[model samples]
Target: MKKLLFFFLLMPILIWSQSNFDKAEKLFQAKKYQEAQPLFEEVLKSKPLDIKTMDYLGEIEAHQKSWVKAAEYFKKLKELRPTTADYFYKYGGCLAMRAVEVNRLKALGMVGEMKESFEKAIILDPKHIPARWALIEIYLQLPGILGGSESKAISYSNQLAQLSSVDGYLSRGRIDVYFERYTLAEKNYIKAHEIGKSKITFQKLYNLYLNKLKDPKKARELKQKFES
Candidate 1:
């Protein structure tokens, strides 16, 4: 009878821990990594073997620029559960971060390492949209000697464009603007605005391209749109 009573007493505590984890997850999704991290750590201290806690820790560290630490956590997570795609994806991200940090070397070793990480992520989870998007970004930014491939970048960007996410369209538009592809850039910016009117899209259209396009009338219209 005493054991049963003790079990019931402890049940609420266990439930509260889970609720805290849930709140942390919501904060993470809302891009509040700093706020979510301590809660995740608290959950870990309570439930040491909880895979979700490690995953959240890894993601939070990644956001916080603690890539080496993030890598360690993700590595542990993969060791505990090798089949999870997100595990591999986030672990790969940690490696990529390390490569970025180690970029100022005599040899281009970091770049190769970064590519390997992204490659493994894509292999483990083909539908991992962030990995695909990141690969495109790398291709665009890297020099030809360091394995940049504009054609590959375009292909990846096109794949991203099919997604419902506005960021994908915005990415394509940014690439266009880089190479002076004005009309294409404008189309992509318009599409992104239609999906979700972020400050970036409005600023690009109203402040830059709209004026250049000699459509001050439409530019004013969009300025009002952004203000509202």
Candidate 2:
């Protein structure tokens, strides 16, 4: 009799929790993150092991630039879903931002972890363009003493090319700009432009002509195209 009574009492609570979860998810889908957060917290208070809710919370925190909090939530998500490449990538990105928010000494300690996490993501999903792009940027930004290498960055850019020709050309152009290889950068940018007429490609060519190459006539043409 007591067991039956307990089951009856628990059923309504479960139903209510599910209802709230549904509402919260609707709000989240609508991009009302601020409004959804409180409802998610309420659901979590009742069902602490809800991985999907946890993932949504992590995404909200990341979008808001709460890197440390985002890391905590994603770490938990990673524990729950160990083999997910996207989860590891999110965790790695959060940690990278947190590392930047800390002191140099603390940041140095985080570099290896961030790199390993991104590498793990890539290894798990080789066609993951975002992870590949992250690694490329990391290689380009770090100093030589801290594992930065232009050659390695170029290698990844080549891999990106294999995945997407436009991205490959754009990545190579950006890297060339970083190295002051303006002529090469312009050629690659032109190739990318030929491939597609995206605002990004136009902007890159426009900036190159206006700022680096000092070809105002060419820059104006690109600028007009972009505005149109």
Candidate 3:
């Protein structure tokens, strides 16, 4: 009789929790993050280890630019789900953003862990595109004395190409632009635009022409063609 009574009492709470979660998810999807956050917190209080709730909270914090708080959530997620590539990637991204806000020495100290996290994400999922892109940026931006290498960046770009031709061309264009090899960048971006023909690809080529190459005529022509 007591067991039956307990079950009946618990059922209402469970139903309410589920209902709140559903509503919170809807708000989150609608980008009403401010409204969704408190509800998510409420749900977390009831189900402390709920992965989806935790992940949502992490993303909300990240969107709000609360990097340290977001990092805590994602770090917990990575620890709880070690084999999940995306969790590691998100954790690394949070750390990288946090590094940018800190003192240079502190930021430098964070570099190894950031690299390791992204590398682990790649190792866990060989075809993970975002992780590869993150690695490419890291390699490109780091100084040679701190282990930066253009060759390393190119290798990841090659890998991206093998996985996605559009990404491959776009990344190569980025590398060329970084080195101020405007003509080379233009060729790569043009190839990417030809293959992808999307807004992003078109913007890449347009920006290169207008900003880097200082060819306003080419940029205008490209823009016209894209619009047409």
Candidate 4:
């Protein structure tokens, strides 16, 4: 009789929690993060180990630029689900963004862990494209003394090419632009635009022509072609 009574008492709370979670999810999807956050927290109070709620909270914190708080949530997620690639990727991304705000020495100290996190994500899921792109940026941005290597960046770019030609060309174009190899960047961007024919690809090629190459005529032609 006591067990039956307890079950009846708990059922309403469970139903209420589920309803709140559903509502919170709708708000989150609508990008009303501020409104969704407190409801998600309420869900967490009822179900502390709720992975979806935790993930949503982490993303909200990240969107709000609360990097340390976001990192804490993602770090917990990675610990809770070690084999999940996206958790590790998000954790690394949070750390990287936090590093940008700290002192250089502190930031440098964070580099190894950031690299390790992204690498671990890749190891867990070989087809993880974002992790590969993060690694490419890390290699390109780090100094040689800190293990920066254009060759390493190119290697990841090649891997991306195998998985996605558009990403491959875009990444190569980015690297070339970074090095001020404008002509080479132009070729890569053009290739990406030809393959993708999307807004992102078109913008990249157009920006390169207008800004770096100083060829407004080419940019105009490209823009006209893309619009038409």
Candidate 5:
């Protein structure tokens, strides 16, 4: 009777456990994210070495704004398979997001971590465009005194240029802005604007005019033009 009771007690748990993935996926598809998290987590606990599970869990954490946990999961993924660019890319991207919600020095430290992860991603897969863009953003934001230079940034950008035209022009403008060369930056940004019609292009121009170029008039013009 004890064995019979034990088997019955375990049946519900086993059935639910077996069906957890399907349940979680259904919830995820329905955007019932909170409902999905625990089941996916339970799956992870049992299958600790499953990289695909880790990737989905990391993505779910990202969607839930759990940046630190997401980064941790991605790091675990990298540890399991260090040569995968996707893992490093996700790790760097998560760290970058977490950095935004913290204090200055902490954010700076996260940026350093982000850069290292991005470099690793590039080393693993030189053609990973998203990883390339992450590196581009780092080189642009980091200070020259702290191992950040426009020249180095520009070189990386140039390598990216060969892959896509829009990316190329955008990168060139970024390099121009870094060196306080407003005219060149402006032209490249405008060209990017023409090709992509993306708000990012003009946004870059606005920052250059306001911060680097020290010309509020041009910045104001861009703001007015772009905002419309």
Candidate 6:
């Protein structure tokens, strides 16, 4: 009799929770994140192990630039789904953003964790564009002491080439510019433009022509093409 009574009591709560979750998911799909977040939190209160709800919440926070909170949620997701590449990538990205606001020493401490998570993401899914791009950016931006290496960045660029020629050329161009290889950068940028001409590509090449090469006429011509 007690077991039967407990089952009857639990059924209504489960149904209510499911209803709330479904509504919240609809709101999330509609991109009403602020409205959806509280409902998700409510469901999580009753069912803390709801991974999907947690994932949505993490994404919402990340979109809002709540890096610390997003990192916390993604860290939990990683714990629940250890082999999932997206979670690791998100976790590392959030942590990387958070590092900027922290003390230099503390920021340095997080470099290893960020690198590990990003590398793990790549290992789990080799062709994951976002993960590879994140690694490329990290390697390019960080200092040598904190694990930044231009060679590693170039290696990622190579992988990106195999995956996406346009991205590969653009990334290589950016890296070359960073290293003061202006001529190489200009060639790569032109190749990228030939492959796919977009506003960003035009702007990059135009800027290089105007500022670095001191060719105002060429820059103006490229600008006209972009404007057209």
Over the stretch 1-228, how does candidate 1's per-residue lDDT look in tens digits? 999999999898799889999999999999998899989898888898898888888877887899889988988987788766667667767776677666456225655655665667667766667877677777887788778888888777777767546767877886887677878888988988887877877887775456556788888888887898
Superior candidate under TM-score, 1 versus 6: 6
Query: lDDT winner among the candidates?
Result: 4
Cα lDDT computed for each candidate against the true fold: 0.78, 0.89, 0.94, 0.95, 0.83, 0.90
Q: What is the lDDT of candidate 5?
A: 0.83
Residue pairs in collision within model 5 = none
| Model 2: worst 10 consecutive residues (lDDT sum) | 128-137
TM-score of each: 0.68, 0.89, 0.96, 0.96, 0.73, 0.85
Worst 10 residues of 6 by lDDT: 128-137
Off by over 4 Å in 2: 1-4, 210-216
Please give, for residues 165-211, the per-residue lDDT of candidate 5 as tens digits. 77889888877776778799889988888787777777777777788
**Positional deviation of residue 203's Cα in model 6 after best superposition, in angstroms:** 5.5
Q: Per-residue lDDT of 1-228 in model 2, one digit per residue for the tens?
A: 999999999999889889988998999999999989888888888889899889999998998999999999988987888888888899999988887789988987888888888888888888877777778878887889999989999988999999999889999998999999999999999999989788888889999999999999999887886788
Q: Which ten residues in a row have the lowest lDDT in candidate 1?
A: 103-112
**Model 1 ranges with Cα > 4 A deviation:** 1-47, 98-100, 165-168, 195-220
What is the full ranking by lDDT, best candidate first? Answer: 4, 3, 6, 2, 5, 1
TM-score of 1: 0.68
**Which parts of model 5 are misplaced by more than 4 Å?**
1-18, 175-183, 197-228
For candidate 5, the 10 contiguous residues with the lowest summed lDDT are 44-53
Model 3 residue runs over 4 Å out of place are none
Better of 1 and 2 by TM-score: 2
lDDT of 4: 0.95
Question: For residues 76-194, could you state the per-residue lDDT of candidate 3 as single tens digits?
Answer: 99999999999999999999999889998898888899999999999999999999888898888888999889999999999999999999999999999999998999999999999
Candidate 6 stretches with Cα past 4 Å from truth are 1-4, 197-228
